[model samples]
Target: MSGLRVIPTRRRGQDLLYVCGTDGRNVAWYDREAARVHLFSEDLRQDVLDALGPFLAGAVTVGPPPVPTAAELVRLALHPDDDLAPNRPGEALLIALDRDPGPAHRLRTDPRRRELAAEQTVGEALDGLEGGGWRTLHSIPLPGGDRVHHLVIGPGGLFAMYALAARRQRVVVTDPLVTTGRREPWPLLRRVRSDAARASYALTAEVRPALVLVEPARLDVTGPPREVRVLTPADVPALARLGGVLKPADVEALYAVARDRRTWGKG
Candidate 1:
């Protein structure tokens, strides 16, 4: 995973934590004074959680839990259908769950849990920009049933941001195609396409799509894969800077339309 840099800045008289991903992406400008830590991931061990709270350059507040998936909920309910029989889709998970449910649940939800941590980390940074010429609407439910982790409007143009915690993995990006270290590519790319269409239609405008691959071991990006920008969490700060400072009125109008959950689907 890429590292983070906490650059200090003051916006509108608010002491802010301007955090950046390794790739110089604009992660968020957090309100150092107002952000209360809320640990959102169970996958993170207590020790890790304890250390993570200092990002605001202070104590970390164990925040609420992260958003979960259908599989997660099913597993949590111990639904019989969630069984992990060998040779099936989640055979290993099933077996592990059978042998011992605790470890298995942790393993299965680890990736998603990391995603939550990333979102929460970034979300706190974003709070400072909430009314300071930037606006964000997160966990937007789409007609396709998947959610957009963050839909942002600011001095920069519109953006559809996705967060994935695929650390220690390699991803090869080529236009119209992507090959990951594990070689599984469909789900990630497919979601990017769907998100682009949803955001575009909802705002009646083109929305740039970006993927924030958490801390990948290596990313060999030859070109924009399928017109989507593959980025690391560290690149968030720069990504935000790319907007070149759009007008406040435009930002407000975009936020108003984009905030309407229905606009996302109708478009």
Candidate 2:
């Protein structure tokens, strides 16, 4: 008789919290209750709900509702999923952040402030990493000292995709960051013929964009977008002078890059 076999395995649960923003394009994952809320637009919410409905078990609210008693609010916040017995896949309760139909200014007030602070902390963290010889590769503009040398690290052959996306979409990728040099080649980029297609592949799949930016040396871009580009990593003082003048659109654009690289199948 064959010997009994044993295998080591791990199950997936709420090891991470995924918060899809009100923007149809933004999806952020959190591991801790930091002082920020994940923002996702209504359009994307539908997609995320469909994808994650199987795991999420709560009433994920998008806007403030009628004033409830303190006790009620606590109950709702704690047992948000009670209304939907087993809040699993195909039974998710979603609310659009814009469902209230309020002024755009009001809509952005809270979220923008929160993101601004987060972005600041992110920038500081990236700077520290770079100082320690860590390369920061992002399609978004990093607010560091002048000579903004950002590296739009692609998944290998996707350099052309980013270049086209930036130019055609009028996406401002201010300065260039160097791609992390990879030892092994990615088969997907080698097989694909178009840059747009490559970008699409990267967007839906990549989970940690900020990490990609800071630690390119550690990643092995074996999935796709194999063709990497070294953008103009110069002119730092000017970008630094601008300070924290980030627009929501700019934030969205960064998401665009992220989405393009991590995308999988169509909606």
Tens digits of per-residue lDDT, candidate 2, 52-88, equal 4454455554421123345643433323322222221
Q: Poorest 10 consecutive residues of model 1 by lDDT?
A: 82-91
Model 1, 1-267: lDDT tens digits are 236565665544666554444644333334456664322123333533334446646554443322334454443442333221112222233344566545554535644455666665555444446555777776666665576767767877677877666567787766545665776655566667667656764554446677767667888877556557777655666645555545666676566555554454543
The number of the candidate with the highest TM-score is 1
lDDT of 2 at 206: 21
Clashes of 1: 24
TM match of model 2 to true structure: 0.22
Runs with alpha carbons beyond 4 Å of true place in candidate 2: 1-14, 17-26, 30-46, 61-233, 241-267
Evaluated at residue 42, the lDDT of candidate 2 is 34
Please report how far candidate 1 places residue 112 from its true position, in Å: 2.7
Q: Which candidate leads in lDDT?
A: 1
The per-model lDDT (C-alpha) reads 0.55, 0.28
